[model samples]
Target: MRSKAAVRARCLSYTGCVGILVLSCFLISSCGNRRIVDHIKLIQSAGYDLDGKRVRSTILIGDYTEKEKTNIKILSTESVSSMDTMQRQNTKSNQSLHTGQMRLVLFGKQFAKQGIGSVLDRLFHDQFISSRLRLAVSGTNAAGLLSSTVNTHDTLFIMNMVEQNEEWGNLPKLNLQTSLYNYYGAGRDLFLPYLILEGGTVKIDGIALFKDDKFATNVDIRDAFVLKLLTENSRNGSILMPLKESDALPDDYILMRSIASKRTIQLVSQEPAPVILIKIKMKVSVREKPEYIRFETKEDISALERKLAAYLVKKAEDFISLCKSKQVDPIGLGDFMRSKSRGWNEKDFQASYPSLKAKIRIDLKIVQSSLSQ
Candidate 1:
């Protein structure tokens, strides 16, 4: 038989084991959350430019905690690669560089043309970095993009502009994670916002389409809206589209506020000639109308809807043809084909992609007029 003292000792040992396990877990969790925020140099936004075999990186660090004051600093360096450039940038920075607060990462046109796989691969592997980080291609010098005068020290000014546009304006939904998904995922390519410096101010130039990981070309911001409608799930945006003279409206210009758009793509055939049927149902508002066109009748409104649908059909068809010619599947037509077919190969898909027939049908309506929602 065990003595009473032996039982107490065993109970104390079990309690000690439980306490040790609880303490270990607390230490592990505390280590995971450990951060010296004040000591870390949080890069707010950064840009990459390629010069020959070298890379130029520009980082923006901003502190705007003080009332009506912002401390802004711009650091740039050229190196063999983006990771190396970051290493060099750390030396130039007053504090240890960290990407915990990164909002935007811009790649210059030349850098994008060369390829962004290495830089992006490194960033993607960095588990500490944000998956929702915005990525853009700069039409101007990447380093020069942030050299302009700014009102706020927080890099939020430039980043907020793009974010707000994607949220409420014409830009599509895109970020580091989505871009990478399209890049690595089969049957679909990637698209990113293109930024250009205009008169010392940065503006969203268009949408940059990628043939794999390399930059292909750009779709104009206006056309980007159409692409967004066709490819993405978005419900709000405005397009100041120009309508030529029609039986209903003799004017050549009109404003369209997009309310909703739904697209249906079907791959009907794979042999002889590949054929895909596309249909888009879109609702828009007439924000501007010319006095030259008298809209006194319901028939007139119907005519306007038909005219707008026709115009959009022509534009969207042209855009799709352009993407086909460039060998880019930004709309994931190949993905749609894969979903429909039993077995598909990349070689067959590539060979048959450009020749694929795209038949479009647009059902459009003017839902609102004169800011009446």
Candidate 2:
């Protein structure tokens, strides 16, 4: 009954309405696609190991509830690729697997000994994984380490241990960025703290030495303490030395607190030998007073300083010997070479590392002592 022009206008209006509806629907669907699983399982820690030709990945999952408590779940898979393994895991779970909250990545002894470059490359290339996550080597099986329960003062005990270690300066802070940097460094060697489960408690055991993506050996906690003192400028810990005047000094241990340390390394071309000269200056506080010695004069202070210096120098020499024996460069010798020399190659440098002689000198100063008696 309407005119032809009016009918055409009405049809155009209807078409416009249809287009608007389609646009609204498209927007809603786009938003829906963006909505992944709401209750996603977040990985707190992960471990990697070699299982035949494939890599075995284990993830320690955790979730938070209204009560503010953590519930942990473990998921593991083996596949040719880490991504593939993750995808397979997603199929088995009702919620999506997320590594957004990942705190640590552990490598098994065998897996690390074999080679970790491929696995580490994959991690470095992943976008979802954070570069700030801490890296550690398991003292035992990586999978077992993650799965074992730890009891501590805090609810999330394992997480607390790592956080405290960083805050207290017990071990060198290792994150994904540090790991990648070490990977590309001149010696292609990296050292990570080893975590061991003992008496249902997790502890930072020692330093795990790595060479070109393979685990070379472990330096005990005592050795790690010396290594940290040598490399880092600031340290807050106790060291035990024998008392001066006691015939049976076995009962006496002087606890020295490191205040400051300066380390300098230089390469020398001496006759019939290639040598690296290391000079260390350290200031320490005497925390434990020995029962056998009376601190009455400057001469006593000088004697104590000399003794401490000798002890530190001996420890450093021992560490250098251990590194040569294991063929691992944890002191950043490669870095030293690369920084000092223009045309230094890692391959040639590593070959010469074992026989390379070292000259270490330690100058110690006693800043303060609580032992006045």
Candidate 3:
């Protein structure tokens, strides 16, 4: 009894209602894939070690059954590849192992030495893994260091150790994203925090130097500070300078803590290879100094600043020498040159890198003489 136009309108209305219902259904189904915390095991930290022909992976997961606190559970498995290690670990775990919350990944020294290109590649491709995830090199083997953290809240302890050092201590900032860029990108090599288990407690020992993807050597924390100064803008990094006999002072050493630092690199020449000049300008607080030194007068402050500047320039040069000897480019000098030069080739750079001439100039100012006061 309805008119033709009215019937057509009614049919369109029904179709529109059906479309809305279908969309709602689709959305609900998509969200149904949401996982509950209780049903999935979230991996907070993972470590990889090469065991002869296979790779061993150690994972730490938090058990949240306790009302007041979360306890850690350690799970380890050995397999041929990183993906297989995960699959094997899942077989052992009660719930599915998820790396969505992973905060740290460590490679054993031996494993890192052999090469970590494949592992780094896998981490880069993983959708759930965060770019901020911290990476490091273990002192010996990852399993040993991880086992030492059984009772303690190992995950947060190690994560905070590396993060605190990078922010306030001597370490330079390095994470998953930076490591990937340095490894995959040309003209630079990657470095990572070197962690060693000392006296049954985990401690950050130094910075692990790398050539391409392989671990080349380790530099102590002091040298690491020099590297940090040259590579990036730094703050709150402290170092000790042992005075030479020629410099007459009551004390034998000066402890300089960086308040802020800036580094500038310039390509001076390129015809006979590259001649690079690095200028490091720093504002530092003298935490420890000779008692005989006086900071009350402008002349006294200026003299002390000159001595500190000379010391830092010498240290920076020594660091550059070591890197050149090792054939490593952690400072990305090559990368800088590549940007400036018209036809910079990696092969040509490597051939001429060992004897590359670099000049370091330091402009250090003593903003605070706490020891003098």
The true-versus-predicted C-alpha distance at residue 300 of model 1, in Å, is 1.0
Rank candidates, TM-score, best first: 3, 1, 2
Which lDDT tens digits does candidate 2 get at residues 1-373? 8999999999999999999999999988887435354567776778887777677888776655536566666788888855576787787677877766777788878778778787678778888888887788887777777777522212244555665664564565567888788887776468888888787656788889887788988887767767776565645645677654567456577778777677887888633546888887788888776676656799998998888888778877999898888888777876776777778788877778877888888888888656345
Q: What is the TM-score of each predicted model, taking all chains together?
A: 0.88, 0.82, 0.90
Tell me the RMSD of model 1 versus the true structure.
3.8
Cα miss at 139, model 2 (Å)?
A: 1.3
Cα lDDT of model 3 by residue, 322-369, tens digit: 999999999998898899988889999899898688999888888874
Where's the lowest-lDDT run of ten residues in candidate 2?
149-158
Ranking by lDDT: 3, 1, 2
lDDT of 1 by residue, 19-113 (tens): 99999998888875456887777888898998888899998887656778878788999888776887899889777888878988889999999
Instruction: State the C-alpha lDDT per candidate.
Output: 0.83, 0.74, 0.88
Q: Which stretches of candidate 1 lie over 4 Å from their true place?
A: 1-26, 29-34, 64-68, 245-251, 371-373
For lDDT, candidate 1 versus 2, the one ahead is 1
User: Candidate 1, TM-score vs. the true structure?
Assistant: 0.88
